[model samples]
Target: MRTAIRLALPLVAAAAALSLTACGDEDASSDGGSGETAADEGGTDADTDAESQDSGQDGEGGSGDGAEAGTDGSAAPSVDDLMGNWFVDPADPGRSHRIVVEGPDEVSFIESLEAEGDLCNRGVYADGTLTFAPEDCLQQGAEPWPDRSATLVLNEDGTLHVTWESGLEEDYTFSESEWGTVA
Candidate 1:
């Protein structure tokens, strides 16, 4: 049980950071690419009031490149189609998570720890999931890196779908600020 919490803490922190940062910068733009506009119809902002109260946990804040509409003028999203900043809202209310990917292969799972700073679980993507190990979460004097993994799927509406091994799942939308240069 301890191990589970250890592994899950970072994710919660990441969510906290995401929600906090996203609310403050609704007009932020991504560089070298069109930015993702904040969705106002999904009732996401309903939690903004509650989320704003706990915005101190500053995690890696970012947005994603604008999704290109498919040839048919309809954007059908796929796991392979997501290659930039994506925000994750966990099943548990009020927790927002974000991930940045260099491509389908390189990814960073970022979470903020109160005193330990940012805990980034780095790994390669395969079969639509990210697998992490001790080395993946490596940072000087960091806590024992608990094994963590999450599956990512893309929704037809261009949101990134996420499911963790622990049965925690949520739908994440593209953020307005892109992280790294897509390759």
Candidate 2:
């Protein structure tokens, strides 16, 4: 049962992502795997999800030691807070990638270099942090990560701090688009 839940989590995550989010810009194509400006995805404050409503009331209690806390000292980045184009800091468009994390599980990452499996083990976000599953799993059209996962956190400075399981740590910043400056 545990194994099944872990395997099915991505699907559940995907569904939740689809149901709770509606994003796109006039120029942004709504194609699967297409990276775009999630912040500009066309929704108002009224689009806020129910999950966010409750988090505002009690999410701050989970803050551990006040490191990387949000505006209200909440440590984890809410799914809505993560909506945007996260490009590699220092702005390298060729080497690493630009990832749009629409939800804890639904991510659209584009690597200009076409590197395969670079993010296969970026970890699966659940219950706050990204975690590695003990059981091996495979993503459609991607490589398999057997015992793979990593650490991802949103800093108070609005930067994404990621330390992959492979000992690679990097920071990602928000941008309106690939060619656009940080927004």
Candidate No. with top lDDT: 1
Candidate 1 weakest lDDT stretch, 10 residues: 29-38
The number of clashing residue pairs in each candidate reads 6, 1
Q: Which stretches in model 2 have alpha-carbon errors above 4 Å?
A: 1-74, 114-124, 131-147, 178-183
Q: Please report how far candidate 2 places residue 5 from its true position, in Å.
A: 28
For model 1, the stretches where C-alpha displacement exceeds 4 angstroms are 1-80, 89-95, 113-118, 138-147, 179-183
- Shift in Å, residue 24, candidate 2: 35
Clash pairs of candidate 1? 15-96, 15-97, 63-175, 63-176, 63-177, 64-175
The TM-score measured for candidate 1 stands at 0.45
167: Cα error in model 2, Å: 2.4
Q: RMSD to native for every prediction?
A: 16.6, 14.1
What are the lDDT figures for the candidates, one per model? 0.45, 0.42
lDDT of 1 by residue, 64-180 (tens): 234444333533333345555565532222233456665554566654222222345556666566777645552312222223787665544555556666555555655434321
